[model samples]
Target: MVKTSMSHEDYLEAIVMLGGTTEVPVRSVDVANKLGVSKASVNKAISALKEQALVIQPHYGDITLTDEGYAYGSSVLGRHRMLFDFLTKAVGIPPEVAEEEACQMEHAISDASFEKWEAFVKGLDV
Candidate 1:
Protein backbone atom coordinates (compact mmCIF):
# COMPACT_ATOMS: atom_id res chain seq x y z
CA MET A 1 0.00 0.00 0.00
CA VAL A 2 1.22 3.23 -1.27
CA LYS A 3 0.12 6.47 0.29
CA THR A 4 -0.39 7.81 -3.17
CA SER A 5 -2.89 6.03 -5.30
CA MET A 6 -4.65 6.50 -8.67
CA SER A 7 -2.65 9.39 -10.16
CA HIS A 8 0.63 7.84 -9.14
CA GLU A 9 -0.33 4.42 -10.42
CA ASP A 10 -1.64 6.03 -13.60
CA TYR A 11 1.76 7.46 -14.39
CA LEU A 12 3.53 4.16 -13.67
CA GLU A 13 1.17 2.13 -15.83
CA ALA A 14 1.54 4.65 -18.63
CA ILE A 15 5.28 4.23 -18.44
CA VAL A 16 5.07 0.45 -18.49
CA MET A 17 2.81 0.46 -21.55
CA LEU A 18 5.20 2.70 -23.44
CA GLY A 19 8.12 0.55 -22.38
CA GLY A 20 6.38 -2.60 -23.51
CA THR A 21 8.38 -3.01 -26.71
CA THR A 22 11.67 -2.16 -25.16
CA GLU A 23 13.25 -3.49 -21.97
CA VAL A 24 16.25 -1.20 -22.16
CA PRO A 25 15.14 1.60 -19.88
CA VAL A 26 12.28 4.03 -19.47
CA ARG A 27 13.37 7.59 -19.57
CA SER A 28 11.41 10.37 -17.90
CA VAL A 29 11.08 12.04 -21.27
CA ASP A 30 9.44 8.93 -22.65
CA VAL A 31 6.93 8.87 -19.83
CA ALA A 32 6.34 12.59 -20.24
CA ASN A 33 5.65 12.28 -23.92
CA LYS A 34 3.33 9.35 -23.43
CA LEU A 35 1.32 10.97 -20.64
CA GLY A 36 1.66 14.55 -21.92
CA VAL A 37 3.39 15.50 -18.69
CA SER A 38 6.60 17.47 -18.41
CA LYS A 39 9.85 15.62 -17.88
CA ALA A 40 10.41 17.48 -14.62
CA SER A 41 7.04 16.29 -13.36
CA VAL A 42 7.78 12.70 -14.28
CA ASN A 43 11.18 12.97 -12.67
CA LYS A 44 9.67 14.24 -9.45
CA ALA A 45 7.03 11.54 -9.43
CA ILE A 46 9.68 8.91 -10.14
CA SER A 47 11.77 10.16 -7.28
CA ALA A 48 8.82 10.06 -4.90
CA LEU A 49 7.79 6.62 -6.09
CA LYS A 50 11.33 5.40 -5.64
CA GLU A 51 11.44 6.72 -2.10
CA GLN A 52 8.33 4.66 -1.43
CA ALA A 53 10.07 1.60 -2.93
CA LEU A 54 7.48 1.37 -5.67
CA VAL A 55 10.09 1.99 -8.33
CA ILE A 56 13.78 1.26 -8.77
CA GLN A 57 16.52 3.17 -10.55
CA PRO A 58 20.27 2.79 -10.75
CA HIS A 59 22.86 5.39 -11.71
CA TYR A 60 21.53 5.62 -15.25
CA GLY A 61 18.76 3.09 -15.32
CA ASP A 62 15.23 3.16 -16.63
CA ILE A 63 12.19 2.91 -14.43
CA THR A 64 11.31 -0.54 -13.14
CA LEU A 65 8.31 -1.08 -10.89
CA THR A 66 8.88 -2.89 -7.62
CA ASP A 67 6.57 -5.83 -6.91
CA GLU A 68 4.21 -3.51 -5.07
CA GLY A 69 4.05 -1.08 -7.94
CA TYR A 70 3.57 -3.86 -10.47
CA ALA A 71 0.74 -5.39 -8.50
CA TYR A 72 -1.07 -2.08 -8.18
CA GLY A 73 -0.46 -1.17 -11.81
CA SER A 74 -1.74 -4.55 -12.96
CA SER A 75 -4.95 -4.10 -10.99
CA VAL A 76 -5.47 -0.71 -12.60
CA LEU A 77 -4.79 -2.25 -16.00
CA GLY A 78 -7.38 -4.93 -15.34
CA ARG A 79 -9.95 -2.32 -14.43
CA HIS A 80 -9.18 -0.57 -17.69
CA ARG A 81 -9.89 -3.78 -19.53
CA MET A 82 -13.23 -4.19 -17.85
CA LEU A 83 -14.24 -0.64 -18.65
CA PHE A 84 -13.15 -1.04 -22.24
CA ASP A 85 -15.22 -4.20 -22.58
CA PHE A 86 -18.37 -2.67 -21.15
CA LEU A 87 -18.07 0.57 -23.06
CA THR A 88 -17.63 -1.23 -26.34
CA LYS A 89 -20.09 -4.08 -25.90
CA ALA A 90 -22.84 -2.72 -23.71
CA VAL A 91 -22.78 0.93 -24.64
CA GLY A 92 -21.83 0.47 -28.31
CA ILE A 93 -18.92 2.85 -28.00
CA PRO A 94 -16.19 3.08 -30.59
CA PRO A 95 -13.03 1.22 -29.66
CA GLU A 96 -10.86 4.29 -29.84
CA VAL A 97 -13.11 6.31 -27.59
CA ALA A 98 -13.66 3.42 -25.23
CA GLU A 99 -9.94 2.97 -24.77
CA GLU A 100 -9.52 6.67 -24.13
CA GLU A 101 -12.31 6.81 -21.58
CA ALA A 102 -11.25 3.59 -19.92
CA CYS A 103 -7.85 5.06 -19.20
CA GLN A 104 -9.46 7.81 -17.15
CA MET A 105 -12.27 5.75 -15.65
CA GLU A 106 -9.98 3.04 -14.32
CA HIS A 107 -8.56 5.27 -11.62
CA ALA A 108 -11.81 6.15 -9.88
CA ILE A 109 -13.50 2.75 -9.95
CA SER A 110 -14.13 1.21 -6.54
CA ASP A 111 -13.13 -2.38 -5.89
CA ALA A 112 -16.67 -3.47 -5.11
CA SER A 113 -18.09 -1.58 -8.08
CA PHE A 114 -15.53 -3.05 -10.41
CA GLU A 115 -16.22 -6.55 -9.17
CA LYS A 116 -19.95 -6.25 -9.77
CA TRP A 117 -19.33 -4.73 -13.18
CA GLU A 118 -16.96 -7.55 -14.04
CA ALA A 119 -19.58 -10.09 -13.09
CA PHE A 120 -22.18 -8.25 -15.15
CA VAL A 121 -19.88 -8.08 -18.12
CA LYS A 122 -18.97 -11.73 -17.75
CA GLY A 123 -22.59 -12.79 -17.63
CA LEU A 124 -23.31 -11.09 -20.90
CA ASP A 125 -23.66 -13.55 -23.76
CA VAL A 126 -21.55 -11.49 -26.10
Candidate 2:
Protein backbone atom coordinates (compact mmCIF):
# COMPACT_ATOMS: atom_id res chain seq x y z
CA MET A 1 0.00 0.00 0.00
CA VAL A 2 2.24 2.77 -1.23
CA LYS A 3 -0.71 5.05 -1.99
CA THR A 4 0.77 5.84 -5.32
CA SER A 5 -0.48 5.52 -8.86
CA MET A 6 -0.18 2.35 -10.93
CA SER A 7 2.52 3.98 -13.03
CA HIS A 8 4.60 4.59 -9.90
CA GLU A 9 4.14 0.99 -8.86
CA ASP A 10 5.35 -0.04 -12.31
CA TYR A 11 8.46 2.10 -11.92
CA LEU A 12 9.18 0.51 -8.54
CA GLU A 13 8.85 -2.95 -10.01
CA ALA A 14 11.05 -2.04 -12.95
CA ILE A 15 13.75 -0.83 -10.58
CA VAL A 16 13.60 -4.07 -8.62
CA MET A 17 13.82 -6.13 -11.80
CA LEU A 18 16.82 -4.21 -13.03
CA GLY A 19 18.49 -4.37 -9.63
CA GLY A 20 17.98 -8.16 -9.27
CA THR A 21 18.57 -10.37 -6.20
CA THR A 22 21.69 -8.59 -5.00
CA GLU A 23 19.86 -5.25 -5.05
CA VAL A 24 22.58 -3.68 -7.09
CA PRO A 25 22.32 -0.04 -7.96
CA VAL A 26 20.43 0.64 -11.19
CA ARG A 27 20.95 3.59 -13.47
CA SER A 28 18.14 5.72 -14.80
CA VAL A 29 19.16 4.73 -18.28
CA ASP A 30 18.56 1.11 -17.45
CA VAL A 31 15.13 1.89 -16.06
CA ALA A 32 14.27 3.85 -19.19
CA ASN A 33 15.43 1.01 -21.38
CA LYS A 34 13.58 -1.60 -19.37
CA LEU A 35 10.39 0.45 -19.32
CA GLY A 36 10.78 1.61 -22.90
CA VAL A 37 10.24 5.15 -21.75
CA SER A 38 12.18 8.33 -22.33
CA LYS A 39 14.96 9.40 -19.98
CA ALA A 40 12.91 12.43 -18.99
CA SER A 41 10.08 10.20 -17.86
CA VAL A 42 12.39 8.05 -15.80
CA ASN A 43 13.84 11.15 -14.18
CA LYS A 44 10.41 12.34 -13.22
CA ALA A 45 9.49 9.01 -11.72
CA ILE A 46 12.78 8.82 -9.90
CA SER A 47 12.28 12.26 -8.46
CA ALA A 48 8.87 11.30 -7.15
CA LEU A 49 10.22 8.11 -5.64
CA LYS A 50 13.00 10.06 -4.00
CA GLU A 51 10.54 12.49 -2.47
CA GLN A 52 8.61 9.53 -1.05
CA ALA A 53 11.86 8.26 0.52
CA LEU A 54 11.51 5.03 -1.41
CA VAL A 55 14.72 5.40 -3.37
CA ILE A 56 17.98 7.30 -3.15
CA GLN A 57 19.83 8.72 -6.11
CA PRO A 58 22.98 10.71 -5.62
CA HIS A 59 23.59 13.63 -7.93
CA TYR A 60 24.60 12.22 -11.32
CA GLY A 61 24.70 8.75 -9.84
CA ASP A 62 22.81 5.46 -10.04
CA ILE A 63 19.65 4.75 -8.07
CA THR A 64 19.19 2.40 -5.17
CA LEU A 65 16.05 1.50 -3.28
CA THR A 66 15.56 2.31 0.36
CA ASP A 67 14.28 -0.39 2.71
CA GLU A 68 10.73 0.83 2.19
CA GLY A 69 11.14 0.70 -1.55
CA TYR A 70 12.48 -2.84 -1.50
CA ALA A 71 9.63 -4.08 0.63
CA TYR A 72 6.99 -2.45 -1.55
CA GLY A 73 8.70 -3.54 -4.72
CA SER A 74 8.91 -7.10 -3.43
CA SER A 75 5.16 -7.15 -2.88
CA VAL A 76 4.51 -5.74 -6.34
CA LEU A 77 6.81 -8.25 -7.97
CA GLY A 78 5.27 -11.14 -6.04
CA ARG A 79 1.81 -10.14 -7.20
CA HIS A 80 3.08 -10.06 -10.75
CA ARG A 81 4.73 -13.47 -10.53
CA MET A 82 1.72 -15.06 -8.89
CA LEU A 83 -0.72 -13.69 -11.45
CA PHE A 84 1.57 -14.60 -14.31
CA ASP A 85 1.77 -18.17 -13.06
CA PHE A 86 -1.95 -18.44 -12.44
CA LEU A 87 -2.93 -17.02 -15.81
CA THR A 88 -0.46 -18.95 -17.91
CA LYS A 89 -0.16 -22.20 -15.98
CA ALA A 90 -3.57 -22.64 -14.41
CA VAL A 91 -5.86 -20.89 -16.90
CA GLY A 92 -3.84 -21.73 -20.02
CA ILE A 93 -3.40 -18.15 -21.13
CA PRO A 94 -0.71 -17.34 -23.65
CA PRO A 95 2.42 -16.04 -21.94
CA GLU A 96 2.40 -12.64 -23.63
CA VAL A 97 -1.28 -12.14 -22.94
CA ALA A 98 -0.88 -13.28 -19.36
CA GLU A 99 1.97 -10.89 -18.78
CA GLU A 100 -0.02 -7.94 -20.06
CA GLU A 101 -3.15 -8.88 -18.17
CA ALA A 102 -1.32 -9.58 -14.98
CA CYS A 103 0.36 -6.17 -15.06
CA GLN A 104 -3.01 -4.49 -15.34
CA MET A 105 -4.68 -6.60 -12.69
CA GLU A 106 -1.93 -6.44 -10.13
CA HIS A 107 -2.39 -2.72 -9.49
CA ALA A 108 -6.17 -2.87 -9.41
CA ILE A 109 -6.87 -6.06 -7.50
CA SER A 110 -8.12 -5.68 -3.97
CA ASP A 111 -6.47 -7.62 -1.20
CA ALA A 112 -9.63 -9.63 -0.53
CA SER A 113 -9.94 -10.55 -4.21
CA PHE A 114 -6.28 -11.42 -4.40
CA GLU A 115 -6.61 -13.64 -1.35
CA LYS A 116 -9.39 -15.60 -3.02
CA TRP A 117 -7.64 -15.68 -6.37
CA GLU A 118 -4.41 -16.81 -4.81
CA ALA A 119 -6.23 -19.55 -2.93
CA PHE A 120 -7.81 -20.77 -6.16
CA VAL A 121 -4.51 -20.68 -7.95
CA LYS A 122 -2.93 -22.67 -5.15
CA GLY A 123 -5.73 -25.19 -5.42
CA LEU A 124 -4.57 -25.89 -8.95
CA ASP A 125 -1.47 -27.37 -7.42
CA VAL A 126 -3.50 -30.10 -5.74
Candidate 3:
Protein backbone atom coordinates (compact mmCIF):
# COMPACT_ATOMS: atom_id res chain seq x y z
CA MET A 1 0.00 0.00 0.00
CA VAL A 2 1.20 3.49 -0.81
CA LYS A 3 1.59 5.84 2.09
CA THR A 4 0.24 9.35 2.06
CA SER A 5 2.57 11.71 3.79
CA MET A 6 0.19 14.55 4.39
CA SER A 7 -3.36 13.67 5.20
CA HIS A 8 -3.91 17.26 6.25
CA GLU A 9 -3.26 18.16 2.65
CA ASP A 10 -6.90 17.39 2.04
CA TYR A 11 -8.06 19.94 4.60
CA LEU A 12 -5.79 22.60 3.22
CA GLU A 13 -6.83 21.87 -0.34
CA ALA A 14 -10.49 21.90 0.63
CA ILE A 15 -9.99 25.21 2.41
CA VAL A 16 -8.60 26.80 -0.75
CA MET A 17 -11.33 25.32 -2.89
CA LEU A 18 -14.27 25.96 -0.58
CA GLY A 19 -13.35 29.42 0.70
CA GLY A 20 -10.07 31.00 -0.22
CA THR A 21 -8.81 34.14 -1.90
CA THR A 22 -5.21 35.22 -1.92
CA GLU A 23 -6.30 38.74 -2.82
CA VAL A 24 -8.65 38.92 0.13
CA PRO A 25 -8.16 36.55 3.07
CA VAL A 26 -9.22 33.22 4.54
CA ARG A 27 -10.31 32.81 8.11
CA SER A 28 -9.76 29.64 10.12
CA VAL A 29 -13.50 29.74 10.80
CA ASP A 30 -14.14 29.34 7.13
CA VAL A 31 -11.78 26.37 7.02
CA ALA A 32 -13.57 24.85 9.99
CA ASN A 33 -16.91 25.36 8.34
CA LYS A 34 -15.76 23.92 5.07
CA LEU A 35 -14.11 20.93 6.69
CA GLY A 36 -16.92 20.40 9.19
CA VAL A 37 -14.30 20.36 11.93
CA SER A 38 -14.24 22.40 15.07
CA LYS A 39 -12.50 25.77 15.09
CA ALA A 40 -10.17 24.46 17.77
CA SER A 41 -8.99 21.69 15.52
CA VAL A 42 -8.44 24.04 12.65
CA ASN A 43 -6.50 26.37 14.90
CA LYS A 44 -4.27 23.58 16.05
CA ALA A 45 -3.63 22.44 12.52
CA ILE A 46 -2.94 25.98 11.45
CA SER A 47 -0.48 26.35 14.30
CA ALA A 48 1.31 23.20 13.22
CA LEU A 49 1.37 24.35 9.64
CA LYS A 50 2.84 27.66 10.72
CA GLU A 51 5.49 25.93 12.74
CA GLN A 52 6.31 23.82 9.68
CA ALA A 53 6.45 27.02 7.63
CA LEU A 54 3.72 25.75 5.38
CA VAL A 55 1.25 28.54 6.16
CA ILE A 56 1.04 32.02 7.59
CA GLN A 57 -1.44 33.87 9.69
CA PRO A 58 -0.11 37.34 10.08
CA HIS A 59 -3.33 38.52 11.74
CA TYR A 60 -6.14 36.83 13.60
CA GLY A 61 -8.62 37.12 10.76
CA ASP A 62 -6.81 35.52 7.84
CA ILE A 63 -5.13 32.25 7.06
CA THR A 64 -3.02 31.85 3.96
CA LEU A 65 -0.71 29.11 2.73
CA THR A 66 2.91 29.67 2.13
CA ASP A 67 4.44 28.71 -1.22
CA GLU A 68 5.15 25.15 -0.15
CA GLY A 69 1.70 24.78 1.35
CA TYR A 70 -0.02 26.14 -1.73
CA ALA A 71 1.97 23.82 -3.93
CA TYR A 72 0.92 20.73 -2.00
CA GLY A 73 -2.67 21.96 -1.78
CA SER A 74 -2.81 22.70 -5.47
CA SER A 75 -1.67 19.19 -6.30
CA VAL A 76 -4.23 17.72 -3.92
CA LEU A 77 -7.01 19.81 -5.47
CA GLY A 78 -5.91 18.87 -8.96
CA ARG A 79 -6.05 15.20 -8.10
CA HIS A 80 -9.46 15.72 -6.50
CA ARG A 81 -10.87 17.33 -9.61
CA MET A 82 -9.63 14.55 -11.83
CA LEU A 83 -10.89 11.81 -9.55
CA PHE A 84 -14.28 13.45 -9.08
CA ASP A 85 -14.66 13.91 -12.79
CA PHE A 86 -13.73 10.33 -13.49
CA LEU A 87 -16.17 9.05 -10.90
CA THR A 88 -19.02 11.27 -11.99
CA LYS A 89 -18.53 11.12 -15.74
CA ALA A 90 -16.74 7.94 -16.60
CA VAL A 91 -18.26 5.70 -13.97
CA GLY A 92 -21.72 7.28 -14.18
CA ILE A 93 -21.85 7.92 -10.46
CA PRO A 94 -23.88 10.67 -8.84
CA PRO A 95 -22.13 13.93 -8.18
CA GLU A 96 -22.49 13.75 -4.43
CA VAL A 97 -21.09 10.26 -4.20
CA ALA A 98 -18.32 11.07 -6.60
CA GLU A 99 -17.39 14.12 -4.60
CA GLU A 100 -17.19 12.22 -1.36
CA GLU A 101 -15.28 9.35 -2.85
CA ALA A 102 -12.95 11.64 -4.67
CA CYS A 103 -12.02 13.23 -1.38
CA GLN A 104 -10.86 9.85 -0.20
CA MET A 105 -9.20 8.81 -3.44
CA GLU A 106 -7.27 12.01 -4.07
CA HIS A 107 -5.09 11.55 -1.04
CA ALA A 108 -4.22 8.03 -2.03
CA ILE A 109 -3.49 8.48 -5.73
CA SER A 110 0.02 8.17 -7.03
CA ASP A 111 1.72 10.80 -9.12
CA ALA A 112 1.80 8.44 -12.07
CA SER A 113 -1.85 7.55 -11.72
CA PHE A 114 -2.79 11.17 -11.29
CA GLU A 115 -0.88 12.06 -14.42
CA LYS A 116 -2.65 9.41 -16.43
CA TRP A 117 -6.05 10.45 -15.14
CA GLU A 118 -5.35 14.09 -15.82
CA ALA A 119 -4.21 13.29 -19.31
CA PHE A 120 -7.24 11.16 -19.98
CA VAL A 121 -9.54 13.92 -18.82
CA LYS A 122 -7.74 16.46 -20.95
CA GLY A 123 -7.94 14.14 -23.91
CA LEU A 124 -11.68 13.99 -23.41
CA ASP A 125 -11.86 17.77 -23.24
CA VAL A 126 -11.90 18.50 -26.91
Q: Name the candidate that leads on TM-score.
A: 2
lDDT of each: 0.77, 0.86, 0.75
RMSD of 2: 1.8
Give the clash count for each candidate. 0, 0, 0
Q: Write the per-residue lDDT of candidate 2 for residues 46-96, one digit (tens) a residue.
A: 899889988888985888888888888877888999999988987889999
lDDT of 1 by residue, 25-99 (tens): 577778889889887888888888888887787754678778777766667777888899889989999999999
How displaced is residue 41 in candidate 1, in Å? 1.1
After superposing candidate 2 on the true structure, give the runs of residues whose Cα lies further than 4 Å from its correct spot.
Answer: 20-23
Candidate 3: where are CA atoms >4 Å away? 1-6, 18-23, 59-61
In model 1, the runs with Cα more than 4 Å from the true position are 20-25
Pairs clashing within candidate 3: none
Better of 1 and 2 by TM-score: 2
The lDDT of model 1 is 0.77
TM-score per candidate, chains pooled: 0.82, 0.91, 0.83
Clashing pairs in 2: none
